[model samples]
Target chain A: MSTTEAGGRIAIEVTVNGTRHRREVEPRLLLVQLLREDLRLTGTHIGCDTTYCGACTVIVDGEPVKSCTMLAVQADGAEILTVEGLARDGELHPLQRAFSENHGLQCGYCTPGMLMSAHALLARNPDPDRKQIRKGIQGNLCRCTGYHNIIAAIDAAAAAMREGK
Target chain B: MYPAPFRYHRAATVEEAIARLVEIGEGARALAGGQTLLVWLKMRFDEPTDLVDIGRLPGLRDIEQEAGRVRIGALATHARIARAPLARQIPIVGDCASGIADNQVRSRGTIGGSLAAGDPSCDWPVLLTTLDAEVHCRGPSGTRTLPADGFVQDLYATRLEHGELVTGVSFALPGKGSAGAYVGFKRCAPAFPTSSVGVQLTLNGDDCTEARIALGSAGLTTIRAKAAEAELRGRTLGAGVIAKAAAAAAAAAEPVADQRGSPAFKRSLIDALVKRGVEVARRRARGETVEVSHEYY
Candidate 1:
């Protein structure tokens, strides 16, 4: 087994939003900080230190992960997607447009995380029912809108994506 | 918030991980997905001198079937297990894994970590106990197996020693005429279970010959409903019999009151969920397809 030096800052490499980054960081630096502070990707916001809030959500290796709770060093050699990576050359992803047109955001603090969560859900289901969509984003806590618009955004995105295909 | 300063070591193999744990002695903690440990660290609830990261260990994240048993590596993520073909064959494993936290958590959290953490409200232990699963552990001394009943000792506690690491869990697959289901009630926090019930039954020509019922978030540790199992054994698994068995299971639970629910409310949920779980299992056993109710939303 390979072992790195203990009790010292370590240099690690990670792929974030289609870009490769190598940096030296403390063992305790969270992935959220590395994204926002180090890499200057402020799209991912931190709402709560606790994992309950989904504000720091990101896609790691094709799955949603809470950036606040994950150590930056631990994510070495992994593929990550922040909210900024959702668009393709200025074309907004269907989910993002759906959120905007359907009024899925009130305070907008939870929008990034909500989009990531919904992105993962649609990637797997393509066409999910109301309950599946609701359960898919259950981890994301939205204080405003009561989740009716959020669910509608996902539903509309799913329909649009299906139709576009 | 930053976690307290601690030494970190990443172990690429199971043996190396266990050796690191032994070297660090009692102040060492193993990190898998870090979903739970990271929270404890940020809160300063625990400050271990050394952390042994076992996420890089190969072959520890697989689900396989051998003969009549299904083996799941301790490192298998909840999402992987939930979507595993073998889990679908067993039914209960998939059901329980599907209900844990949500998409993100299931994608990162490992089955082994959750089982080793032994949170009373976690769904894996409750379902494993009902299915008579076996936990396999490895240490410097060698490998050992513990029955599910003996693996979990208390809330947030397990029988794992200082140098031990969970390698895998194995259990017999449900037979042709057997079925299993897990039902629970949750509010606000989707990760934690308020009251949960797991039921597995074997049907022999419309008669329930074998039954196992386990309830979680109702006691210090997940518990088996012996009286409820007895009530279902040797009887036809109809609505009336299932209701009686559910009542027996609920009566046997010793739930504690908390903000999520009161003791009495938990008991009532136990009764309601157990009946539904058993009825669902029975329907599956009979090869009848039933859609899950979306009434709770």
Candidate 2:
């Protein structure tokens, strides 16, 4: 067990939103911290800091995971997708557009996690029902209690995605 | 809420994992999905000096049927197990696997980690106990197997020693007319069940030839209610008989009052869950597609 100074840093290489990065991080540095603090990708919010809140949710190697509970070292050699990756070529993804059109966000604290989880869900299930959408985002919590609109947004996004939008 | 700094070691094989755990000594913890361990680490519940990452160990994630039994590798995530062909063959497996935590947690949480945590509220231990599963382990002494019925010895404690790691779990395939159900009640998807029941039965028409009843979140460890099971074995599963068995199961529970409910409340909840579980198992045994899971309010 080496101290932070004595143990030094472990090197890791990961791809985020189609970009690759190689950095040295402490063994205890959480994946969320690496994404937000080290990589300057502040779109991945940390709510609750515990695994329960799910605000730190991100897709790692095709699985939606609570980044707060995962160590940066554990995510080495993995591909990560965060909230910042939701847009392309300055155009909002269908999910983002649908969320705005459906009033899916209020205080916006839980929006990032909801978007990532929904993105993963839609990727796996191109057309999800209301029940499936609810189950998909059950890990994320919105303090504003605006889940109905979020579900609607996901539903709309699924429809658009199926139409090849 | 950051976990304290610790040395991290990634082991490519189970043998290497065991060796590193032993070398790192008592202050080392095996990291699986980190769905449970990382939470405790953040809370400073048990600060270990080293974490042996075993999440990427190959061959430990395989779930396959062999001969007369189904073997689930320790690293199989809950989400994977929930939709596996095995889960379709055994609906109880899907019921338990899909009802744990939420989608994100299920994607990372492993059956091995759930059982290793030894938490009474974890659904795997109770579900495995009902299926008469055997936990396989490997350590400095090579390998060994233990029955799931009493694998969890106490709260947050198990029969596992310092260097031992659960490699997998296997259970005999349920014969014809045999089925089981896991039923629980919780406040939300992420919350642990207040009280849950797993009921497995082999029935010939209305007569129950065999029964295994287990209660979770009802005691310090998952309780195998043999007395409750006796009330059903070799008996016609009438409403009256099921009520008696449910009552017996409830009486066997030693629930401690917490924010979930009072001890009396948990007993009543257990009784209801046992009845529901038995009914679901019976329906499934009759070739009915009945969906049962952790009811969230």
Candidate 3:
């Protein structure tokens, strides 16, 4: 079997949100770049090359992942969900609404990752305490809001989600 | 930034992965969850010519409990192991997994990869050493099992040869009255453990029959606190005995100063964490409920 060269492009198949996408990408293409450049889904922001900042966070198969750190080939044949796909049928996700209403975001650069991280938290735990909420967003770094409103937003969203169910 | 150029091969089976490793020889690296390797790649620390992706390999993602021991496959993600029924039943493994980096890291990191990477700061090495775990590796020469202590040779180094893949790790189940705990201290943000201690104690009618203490981030590798274990062997679980054992454990640690913490601070932290770990284990063994103070996410 002939192997693709290092700098050559290779075919990649990945499911973003619920849509399947097939594209040829460079071997060095990051999952973040693939989502932003190839697919034109820019909800996943890239803040730092280091994994410290969770600005490029996304849900891959029910788990929150740092998209910048993972290569596009690594995500081949995997299910990915970005922040843009959170809302359904023109309605905002409860977390999104909570962030807006509770002033969870300031500059909004970290909101997408924060929302995605919180979505994973709510999926695992519909009702999380303040400590849990803090732990959930520990990977996401927010410079503007100081995380006070973010924590409150998650708490309120949890309550809203529980009430809705 | 993107990683340096490298050929990628997704192996469908363990045999295929091993074969690919053999083919690629020294220029190949196995990809488990890519939590650490990807970071290193992006930083241009080390570039491999080929990446043997083992994420799809079968039979390397389960947690099995046998007659005498529990077996954890190498590809088992930390998240999966954290939620594994057998791990929760065992408790120590679950606690250790739960205490790893954070939700994002745990979700994408694998126990096998972490242990194989042989980082002294990781949680599994310390806990596995304390539990006397055995690491099973598969190579061209067939399969072999090495005791966890012998498996890790030094910092970021293992006894594993080229083309060898860690298949699984096995450890004996804790006895009826045995309990264990992993305690550590970390600074703000990301919450990497500055100094961590793993303690396991087996009790017989309020007296400790066996005790094992392992300290991580205290040296080139996790060190067993033999003197501390000896101190607690015949003594009843109490604050005084715990303090003595903790002091011995701290004295045994030989840590270096790093940005996360200082040598003196880490040495002091060893004692505090070991004391806390032993107290927590003893309390749990006595069926007493106590809140554990953990700062890490």
Report the lDDT of model 2 for residue A60. 95
In order, the first chain's TM-score in every candidate is: 0.95, 0.95, 0.96
TM-score of each: 0.95, 0.98, 0.95
Off by over 4 Å in 1: A1-7, A163-165, B291-297
Second chain alone, TM-score for each candidate: 0.95, 0.99, 0.95
Q: Which digits, one per residue and each the tens of the lDDT, describe model 2 over residues B11-116?
A: 8889888988998799999999998999999999989898888999999988999898999999999999998998888999999999999988998999999999
Which tens-of-lDDT digit does each residue in B161-258 have in candidate 1? Answer: 88899999999988878887888777744447888888889987669999999998889988899999999999987879888998999899999998
Q: On residues B1-297, what C-alpha lDDT tens digit does candidate 3 reach at each position?
A: 567899887788788888889988999998898888888899988799988888767888888888988999998988898888865576677778877777788888888898888778877888899999999999888999999875677988889999999999999999889988877777744556888888899997669999999988888888889999999999887788888998999899989988977888888889889888888888788877554533453
Q: Chain A TM-score of model 3 versus the true structure?
A: 0.96
Clash count for each candidate, listed in order shown:
0, 0, 0
How well does candidate 3 match the true structure in TM-score terms? 0.95
| Evaluation by lDDT, superior candidate among 1 and 2 | 2
Clashing pairs in 2: none
**What's model 1's overall lDDT?**
0.85
Q: Which stretches of candidate 2 lie over 4 Å from their true place?
A: A1-7
Model 3 off-target regions past 4 Å?
A1-3, B289-294
Candidate topping DockQ = 1
Of the candidates numbered 1 and 3, which has the greater DockQ value? 1
